[model samples]
Target chain A: MPHKVIRMERTRDHSSARRPVMVAIAGDSAAGKTTLTKGIAAALGASRVTTICVDDYHRYDRQERKGLPFTALHPRCNYVEIMEQHLQLLATGQPILKPVYDHDTGQLTRPELVEPREFVIVEGLLPLYSKLTRACFDIAVYLDPPERIRREWKVSRDVRKRGYTVDQVLAELERREPESAQFIRPQRAHADIVVRFAPAEGHDDTSNSPLSVELMLRPTVRHTGLRGLLAEIGQRTVQLRLIRDEDGIPVDALHVHGYAPREESRMVQKAIWSRLGLGDGDPVATLGDVGNGRRSESLAITQLVVLDHLLRAT
Target chain B: MPHKVIRMERTRDHSSARRPVMVAIAGDSAAGKTTLTKGIAAALGASRVTTICVDDYHRYDRQERKGLPFTALHPRCNYVEIMEQHLQLLATGQPILKPVYDHDTGQLTRPELVEPREFVIVEGLLPLYSKLTRACFDIAVYLDPPERIRREWKVSRDVRKRGYTVDQVLAELERREPESAQFIRPQRAHADIVVRFAPAEGHDDTSNSPLSVELMLRPTVRHTGLRGLLAEIGQRTVQLRLIRDEDGIPVDALHVHGYAPREESRMVQKAIWSRLGLGDGDPVATLGDVGNGRRSESLAITQLVVLDHLLRAT
Candidate 1:
């Protein structure tokens, strides 16, 4: 053993008296993980939150993946062990030097230092991919928008922002479907809340109606004050019902209708926000931004619900 | 809490059955840290050793440092917290995504994944700068060559390899002297062994004599077979004596005379190697390389002693 040295401690103290609350929002590509994460982070204030995308752990850049038999969706294409290790560090209120994967350039850039704040929102493809990863989160969410809607969102985002052709996006989507089913979709079963955004029943897909959202709240984690809040806000626009989950277990399904007037969603958001005991201010207005100044009432309500869970966990 | 998913475990297992033995080699810039580290790593076999330079944690690049009042020697100038966190990880036989500071380009480049093997050699300016860092090592070494020799080595190496002009190197050295005294030199007290390589006392400075080495072995850690080996090999070429250290404490000073013949140094090296119980073969031939095919007998002997400590620690 080496001799121990006793030196006066230096450097800014990074130890937190209380560990940061951790939330995981996991889904497949273009599944609105980032949008939902942005809302929760904004609600918590930027200084109090740290948001990280675990896709930055990709083992292969886009060009390298092209040469491989598996797509980026496969565990082999990512540094999953490193991701789990980082998550464990964050859950324990420590810091990590996180890797950066440039989505547009498809290159691994320099890493950035991530110091966990009062709240940490980890959103990516594999945040809930394993039991070890799942153990690091206080709340786990899986985004499961209708397949058609998700495909459309992917094409629009990649072509407009990521310099990919629509045809290229479609081809990539087709190639990733098998892995998506094998690796990504299976994580939904482990989530405390499964969120799906899609058109309302009997509504035309091409119509100008905003997407409605269904939040399946599993009993795995206690949803304190949520069921009562849902029951109190039970109008035509926001409703709560009992439904059988995929595992044939009874779970509460909360529905937020998109076409409902904005004021109704605001009422529900305010109702949930008030339960947080965070004062009388309305929820952040930017919660449901879907790009280009477009906002969805359903998205805002779903974000508020997730934010409620994060605060309760803390 | 999130529900745990019972999925088949995947990804490569990184947990080691036994933690890797860690060694810290601390010294000032151009103080033969890397040269010493290379010899040790080579002796241990590259596959069984992981060597990292802690200077990679620089918070600023060359261009950024120019605008600051302090040099890289300041603890604030580097990400000391992250470095300590990483050292703890490596000490526990875990992996780290280590940052890279490109010396040639003066840029912070992409991080590399470092997995600790049977032996880990961490060499850099501030490995022993703090108590937390010092606690991570099994054997701590400090290089303390004379000021003139160290300056000459710095100027030669930086000018030839790092693209710095002679005048710039000299000016930078003058600027860094204060911090070097305040930060770097004090770590010598915490080391298990202090090694100084310089010309023999009465030898002319301009002569081509190989640098002699004097190792100050502290009583902080047990130097198990070393005293007996020194007594058995006592000669004019290799002498062991007690000397009052800077702290006024008596310590064993082992001198390997650079003026001694090669056969005499070989005998000492062989004697140390045999006691390691590794094999009857001679010590590693590459242990004393000082670059450009040059070899130093004194360096080889010093490395053999350090290697002995590492093996004993395991």
Candidate 2:
């Protein structure tokens, strides 16, 4: 384990001592990590936010991993030391030659020159797997959608984009489950916010209805004005309540209804947008979109909420 | 002012004393009163639920109101006495001769027979305007969408369905504004739940984004298990928080996000369903729909939550 003081010191820039705010989004495969990061990037403007998939550190290609004793989820499957070093560099507003892993061909591709921007989002399966890496982010999020829903998403995505059959995807999921439990799920304990998109009760027709979102807001960072905002909106589009997390720690849980009408969502959005002092600019237009021409008021608001912490840090 | 004790005593039947659970949904024109009533009726089974639009109690025709001192929104513009009597009758599970007002032709049409079902839903502009009428309801809901959103809805609806020009509709809205303020908006204070629908901020294109819903759960009714359910699900779909109402009463406000996916909505629905002992049947398939083949998980859950209180009273 790395010393906390060392990682803490690295968060400040070496030259100017004014560090870029770093955010980490960790999740299992197909758990909506990139989707969330993408919306945040778009919301903050692409130039101001830089996104890096830390899975680029995979030590073996897909073909090599197949013959290895352990799965890619294990710490030994990647260059953990190098990943930690690069994270420290990025935290200090330095640049690095980051490795690349291509999912289509399942191979280690070309390395790329990566520079830290005003805001850096590190997303992948293991971004928060270790304390050293976790310390790199000012705000860390874990995407923990229900296992069944995640499986469905994985199968659909693999079939559409990776040319994989349902059977192959299922088999891969089984292979990954053990390591996921050992490595990925534990990272949630370290996250400032754990977000899950799942079906609400009696809504078994997940095929048509949108998934509702639950955000377990851990006490790692100070979340100001959210309680006041939830009170004023007085609608179910966004809710705030005190709850005990899995660790039995008292936390504020905010649930954003996915099937909420646009009208209900806007009130909460306005509350968050105003609180962030992002001014009267259009946060919903720029940040509210979640692709497929569908705009997620909650997603946009969540991004802004996360941005609130980063802005405060700056 | 009607005596509360007298009206309360009249709620039970005189003979067998088996009263139908009465629900009142009040809102301004085109504020989604019918849409909400339809979903609730569908959820509880249309045969089991009788819906009556109290706007049918208009004493004068639309043409007659034009020559009167006030607009249709005025209590004097409606047959409030007859409405109060019929509501009392319905609360005791009796039948009544209901008058009809045709919005399409703006005429006083033929009267019809109405028998109270197991559940009766009374929705209109002034269902909660009078103390006598308010006592007839087991649950009262006010559709309090944002003024601008309601105005947009009114313009579109009147232009398409009533064959009125946009300018004409706007003029009528302007004409009705004072009475709306005096009579309609105040009814919200008496409601157990004030539901608002609005376009999320930044999503100016209401046509493209789904409307969000916020539910103000007043303390007048004891909402059991909702907070526990929110904590257990650990999602943002259903959130409960302490809020101060317009009258400065501290209340528990539950917000149901409109853009929530079916998965998240289903979880909350199941919790509320089970708590209400609604059995294992599919309320989401029937009551969850918002129209045009869309299902609102929050709307469905809200219906069930209200049903819980009614059942408890029974």
Candidate 3:
């Protein structure tokens, strides 16, 4: 198996006796990692989950990296050792002075005290790139949207929120491609779950239709059997398949159709909710919805699957 | 495992015989078996495929079956022995004088000669119920739409095509429920694939939207890997997942979202065609496009999956 189950080695002095489970969400820039993290925190209840962006660990500010040969994707460009030490502390139920990088200003801003909660979600470009850092995570996910879709999302996000023109975003993508390949994409092979969200091939209403989602579940962890859930729904919008991964290891792949009929998705959603032992009302309401009313059922289900594991972990 | 792969006995045969690959699609009355069978035949090319409805094996005419205590779904109401013998004959590429059951007139019509072709799809109420008959097939599928959805479909079909009143059809469904459970539903466990088509939940425009489809791919047969095809299309609407079946057997399930964005479905359709080694034109144009221009992508994909196996068998 490409994914090895992590055994955390706690190394810290901490006040809280309770250990917080850490989850790592790693992906390239503008890969919706933050959006995913926010949704997860919301679903788990914000007070119970602490969210961190390790991009703040960059040793050099954006302006400083501009003069350097390497992009921020390089390990040398970031305080890798410090990040590793802090992760070790957090994994053992301690607090850390987490650094903050202002994405809008392209500068290292204020540092914040992060106390470990019941759950800690670390989302950034290179969370799983190192063995020491990866050990802090009980569950690791790699977001791998298609290049075209990611480009579109990144371009639009940068232009609207960060005062960058489309040309600048595209140029940055070109410059970061090599670094992303070297430092980021390889993390996918190590992930217990790989999620890809993309537009359906010929969808005319691209702006409105929910993006389809494909989740590859590596056998690093056992999953709650879904046959019963699928039977209850009796719809084909959600499917499960046993397949061989790229590395020729057996894995389970799950697909959630984007244009899933409302009833079908509801039945599945309810089934998942009940599985998680959650109460009524959509737990994944804010998930992947962002500014739009439209929500991806596949995305919600993906979140639920992860949450299901975390809940059962205790 | 509930589903066991069939191994042909290869009883008796004649001629310059190349054995025809047999497929059994079993379901309840008006469960869309004929429609599914038609699509399969069309996709494989009509000349190269032979379609058989085993409902013809009904030993009693419709009127006769009604007078008896058992419904048409009961095995005793059908000529099980002859049906099994003929299936064995057809399995090895022989011809049979198939009995005809006419739904329009509720009569046993003239028998027809059915010559085995490159592909043979046997679709009806109980094709998979008997072990001998099931062993004649290379692949078997069960249609298992939700009871509510099926009731609607059955009522609409019987009223429109067979001149049955709504009340009569509804009453018939009630009467046949017992036999359907005893003789038909159990066949699902024996099938290599179980298919369900239903309207999306909570949608106001249920009639306008295409029904979603879910297919459970049991380990009764080895399936052509779809990961490569999914990757090539770069769409998330069609997905595969590994799940445990009801019998605790691991299986792969595929779901095609209904109301699938046209582009998404088109991409999947194109991928399936290419997977089948077919050219640019759709080999399944007539598939699942029952009426209107609207087509169920899930249904078409289901057909393609089965077609993929049939084509590979030869």
Candidate 4:
């Protein structure tokens, strides 16, 4: 039919040009997805990155969900098909009038026009939930913070920022646990890199130390220069080890020590940045920003690794 | 690149399935596009038809456009790229979260979900404006009423239904004429069928008769069984002639007399409907409904001709 012929022609025309590199960072609510995405986009330069959250595909507002049988974490609560369609468009270097979900107001607001640039960072709970969406990404990352740390992060953020009481946030977290298990955590298996930020194991002074990061780098995508960089930087700041994953598959896990001196962590960051071929200079100052003028060297290093994958794909 | 490869695969998968047949009816504002689309959709049965207006792609609301240099009719005033992208999706039987423009309030309101069914009738100001969009339709129709008649229709509709003053409507129509000439009228050349409804030429009782229709059927599509059907209906009610179009192209012109008796028109409608293979019965009762309980035989016949083309393409 003419419909098929015309679409095939259009697809050929679209593919002849340069397309944007797509990166999906998926995790549960308050799992530091936004923080990780912000760091990567900053390092890539704001002008070259288009960042969007798939939570905007929510099929219901907060008020409507209160009466529903399932929580927002359920796939039924989202317009997953439209999400797939829009993601396909963005993945092909096209623009989309993306829907807006106002987290502060808990409402589905007016859509905004999003034009893909050199790179696109898609961060949300369901970015990697489907095969169609996962196919759109060149690099997929899943944030897997410890449950205790994540609960603390969620409580503090919701109370201070989202105008929710401590009890309400805790109750909602409990309500979402089952869907999180069924829908959110399973996406970890599809990611090329699974990042876990938590207090360092066997570290006695955890409260005074920053959260360390362990990146489980699967071989689906090449981790260029990562092993050599870790060796050069020394185990005092970062270490790489061969470990058996939960699935009993051998994988490389790179750990960035949170208790390491700031200078040592900066050295690790600098070494990774130098390999990026983005010219001879220090890394971007905004890479590790964690609000209120604070910075995390581990976060910066993790972002650099993700950036390296994106650039290497290009 | 993976982006190109993935998109090509997606396109192939989409084309392997059945896609919706798209029909575009394009014309200037108040050119009777919606009325024509309504009649065709009514004949096709509502369960199998999806109707959308492209005017919803306006980038600015009425208050915002008040201070702009151009009117809504200008190409730059609408999100033409997004419109093209969404049309490509719908043409392939995909759904879209379409934006809505509130005509009564002159505001851009929330978007709504639109899923394409068996037949999609896209009626609007610029559905056939671009090559990409034009490629999506199986049948492209341009409504080209005489400017005098169109202006009268616009003035009456705007003053009565849209809460516009007669003077304001006239002034706005004058302002839009240049853009309409530049951007809107040129699409008429791309249409497979050009329909004009106006007072019959040299008719003595024009005011007492409904508007007659002249359909210039181009050879881009096969107007199956039309000549034989017209011969059977006889020239007193409907006639076919070989005519040269504005571009000096030879085409078939079908004229339906507005003053033809209802019984004679029903015979023409039944002849067309029977050819559709929809079983032995009279044509649908709602084919020619105008607003406020009025019906036009000529309009019903024109809709039947379009329905014939749609079913033939299927």
Candidate 5:
């Protein structure tokens, strides 16, 4: 060899030197974390952002747990503490050897190393389920798909990708329902935004384009900015309806349909971009502030709101 | 609006004229079944072959078997009969929905529909462990790596591939050794050829190239062609003097590595082609006179071999 070569290790971004930001998207299995993340990732571009699945922290292999009494959803059954530590590490701009889940083989065949960048989106069944985990996301979201729709998505996926019979998939769903409801579903209350995607009222189980999105926002003084974000999102290419209901809950809901033409969906995505007031390329890069852990992010904004109040009083 | 569609059903090649040929490569875990199949597949070409791993037949999901007593290698832990049935179907030139395995991720994911074309290579730890299964293979080869070498290979593979620490892999190996000996290693006696890849005597562990072929020639005259086959093999290969002294078992003291170079190996393989003498095309096409459970290629040759007197009379 002519000379020894060295690839420089990536250093932390000084862009967030003044303040830290974090964003978390929590959801049950197949509850649109991927779909939602795609929109966000596309909007944000690549440089000032990073995203990861929380399940990447799982502790056991598929073959190892063949006849166990407890389900995977149980915290005791997982390496929860290690996962929490890794999340903290990633949030602080570090690399971690994330656990790999081969969805096709249903075996943890290999482990891959992941280097986290800036705007991290952590999505999975239990990102919002734990106290320590919840402390790591600045803006937390939980997907709340209707049971029927979620189960249907699961059924189709199992038949197509997994080697299970339709009957076996159904049986598994039944067995999993209790644990899902107990351990997974309730995490919705803890989220800053709750998203639900379901089939339209008229379409039951037949149509291919029944996918929809219903987002629930937690009530806070940030309504003006949130509404502006929704309005901008509405102006985008997609055919999404942003409905604000004053039904005593401080939240917002938006729904996207599989029935909507692709061209229509593109429009709504653009409107969300306009909220940041950028021309050529700064919509997603602007949302870098959203990556803070839930409680810490809350405290930061609360401090800002408090400062604003103190300034008005003075 | 345009309509989206699913993929079309695939077609299988069943020439309706001939009985199917089944080639079985039996070996312990990490014992080169996959490596051997790759060579055979390349030689035969993809147009005439389809290979399926027996590992995909695992019955339990990862999260389900946390505290189970048995590991996946135990026959009872897998759906062996279902796998055998599927093999028979594939051997007969039919396509079946094979299970998907994502070795990197330990998730029992979706099934993939595989349409069989020509050759079916079923490789696994227990491929030759069952009598009914043995009846299915037209030609069977066993991989017999020494215990020490196999252990080292398994360790490196598990750690690099499965996110496992060296200690965990070692524990798993220790646990499986007993079962591996009882179930996997014993299948060697049923093999037509036993392939052992180990370092030659006086060489260090760093020796990378090592292959020994122990031909188990059944005592029969029809196999007079067998000697010709070995001769052809010998042309491309070096024979180690594995002669048994008074003890009667030759393998323990022998170290037979093929002295033939790459070019010579190819020549030996070609010569083997000339000696089998089955009119060039698919010799595995017809079921010649099935007295035993085997799907024989030649009636007269096979009949002579069935009775022990064929060599003396001929």
Candidate 6:
């Protein structure tokens, strides 16, 4: 892993001195960072959460910054240090005066006040880019939607919501390709967890269908603190026999191949849960479904695992 | 006038022909450039229009461009020359590849192709700043809403649309004030028509109702082109009168004000059309009953006059 993963050992009750719990969701534009964060935040409940999209700290208005030596994806184009400072402040349970940029008109709009809560979810492209920023997050995840999927989402959004035509959107996709590859994609290596959502290929699965969401856990965390949830994830998990790409590194890549049978997935979930030893007797059943669509069997599994660990550790 | 006004002796016909007609709508951010241009384009019909927001051309992503030196409102922060060249291509009815930037995410997105039509609305803070770009537009207008009104509008918009709270919006407003005065407001003098919208204040024989809207047309036409309409609008023409400040400058420049008595506003419309020789005929009737509530009434009136003149002259 490009990032050093520190094991979070169970803290003694006397050590509970109100530490800031920050979560970072980093990804390229249209990479589903917002959606993934939304799920996590909703499950965590709004009272315990607050979100800060890094886009708020942009340096220039859309028009003025064009054709400059640098593009927005570059760290030099924005107030990254200030953002890091703000992240630190939030993690320390302090309030921040955040900037607002208008998207439709491309203006640096008024600012907003952000008071920290139990969790601060920072979601944006460069959230995990710097060591300083990475240090702010208690947990970090990267959304790795396929380029094709991102492009589709971008084209539709620009045309429908942003008043751009299809041709205009396509042009942008091409122009940003180089920077995206160089600046954005590299952030994934630093992620503690990488979550990607895609339609089931060669399967009769609608978007909300029982499509398997692949969550790659670093080999460093075999326990993942969510063994119960992993066991519950069951058939949704595709343990890819651990292979690395010319990297002498160990890889624990998972690929359920998507849209797998629900029954089989249920069984897999149970096995992972059994290992955690909290599947049956606990109130894990009380956890509501938290995944997208009615196809949320996977969500129940994740919830059980997370809640179990959270409760036991507390 | 700050900008050299260019007017065609006759209406320029739509063409795949050479020399794209660049229409520039320059003003401070949130000075109603986009709102005004959208009305103009829709009035002309999308088939004859293509719009390019100058904001789409930013050179940096959200994080890279901050605290460098100049504000995004300044010319140096942008690739002004390149944008001017692009404008040259666009004005002559040619397809040009344009860059895209997502305002919400503050990222320079992919590039897209823009096909020219009869007209293109190139709008932004400094769309009119560069001399080369100035050469591209056949018609130029500036929206200079009143300072107090602008501040309020800005605060409200940032809070509602841009994910900002009241205090943050106020602070940003304070920060942007200097740039707005120096870079944006001055551009108004360069326009053929400087538009001001504000709420209509009390006058003799006018009710205390809140709906009255007043449009102050700077360089108010020497002669209301439509003779008959001019006569009817003769005395009541004080609607175009803008109160000047102590410096003998428009106290509240480009203020879009509201006036009550819907009938009076309709009369203004009727009088305008009567001058154009369109009369209460189909073209005149096609205009819906406008009131203090419909902010676009005055703008639509101006557009109708221009379009009538264009179609008739051609």
Please state the interface RMSD for every predicted structure, separated by commas: 6.8, 36.3, 33.4, 3.7, 24.6, 27.1
Which lDDT tens digits does candidate 6 get at residues A4-122?
01111111122332445677788988776665565455555678778889977777778877757666777776667567656755665555556666778777654455777776778
Residue B199 lDDT (model 2): 62
The CA lDDT at B106 in model 5 is 54
Give the alpha carbon lDDT tens digit for every residue of A1-314 in model 1: 22221221333244553478889999999999988888788778889999999999998777888799999999999898789889887876778899999988999887898998989999999999987888788899999988998998899899989999999999999999999999999999999999999897778562367889999999987875888867877486788889998789888998888778777778777878888766655574757877677788888889988888889887
Better of 2 and 5 by TM-score: 2
Computed on C-alphas against the true complex, the DockQ of each candidate is: 0.37, 0.00, 0.00, 0.37, 0.01, 0.01
Over B84-109, each residue of candidate 4 has an lDDT whose tens digit, in order, gives 88888888778899888899888876
Q: Which pairs clash (backbone N, Cα, C closer than 3 Å) in model 4?
A: none
- Tens-place lDDT digits, model 5, residues A1-314: 00101110122233442212456677666565665564455544566556777665445556665677656666655666556655655655555545566666656543444566545677777777766676665667676778777777677777876777889878877776777888887787787666666665577763243444455556632445535543554333223244554344545553445455444444443343443333465432322122222111111222122222212211
Q: What lDDT score is found at residue A201 in candidate 3?
A: 55
Residue B307, candidate 3: how far off, in angstroms? 1.0
lDDT of 4 at B75: 88
lDDT of predicted model 2: 0.76
lDDT of 3 by residue, A1-314 (tens): 00100100121112344668888999999888987777678877878998888888887888888899989989898877557756765776766656677787788643555788989899998889887787777889999998888888899999999999999999999999999999899999989889888775567455577887788888887774754565456367777778898789888887777877767776677677787665565754645455556667777777777777677665
Better of 3 and 4 by lDDT: 4
Cα miss at A237, model 6 (Å)? Answer: 5.5
By TM-score, is 4 or 6 better? 4
lDDT of 5 by residue, B1-314 (tens): 00100100111122442324556778887775665565445445577667878777666656554567877778876656546545654554544445544567655554444556555677887777676566565666677778787777777777876888999988988888888878887887776555566554556453243334343332211235544444445443544344552324444221234344545544434444444332363322321222233332112122112111211221
Predicted candidate 4 versus true structure: per-residue lDDT over A1-314, tens digit per residue? 76556554764465544578899999999899999888788777778899999999998999999999899999999999889888888887888988888999998766788999999999999999888888888999999988888898899899999999999999999999999999999999999999999887776343356879999999889875778777766579888988987877777999888879888888778888888876665574858877767788888989988988889988
Reference-based lDDT, residue B55, model 3: 83
Give the Å error, residue A204, model 4. 7.9
Q: Give the CAPRI class of candidate 6.
A: incorrect
**Every candidate's TM-score, chain A alone:** 0.93, 0.91, 0.91, 0.94, 0.71, 0.75
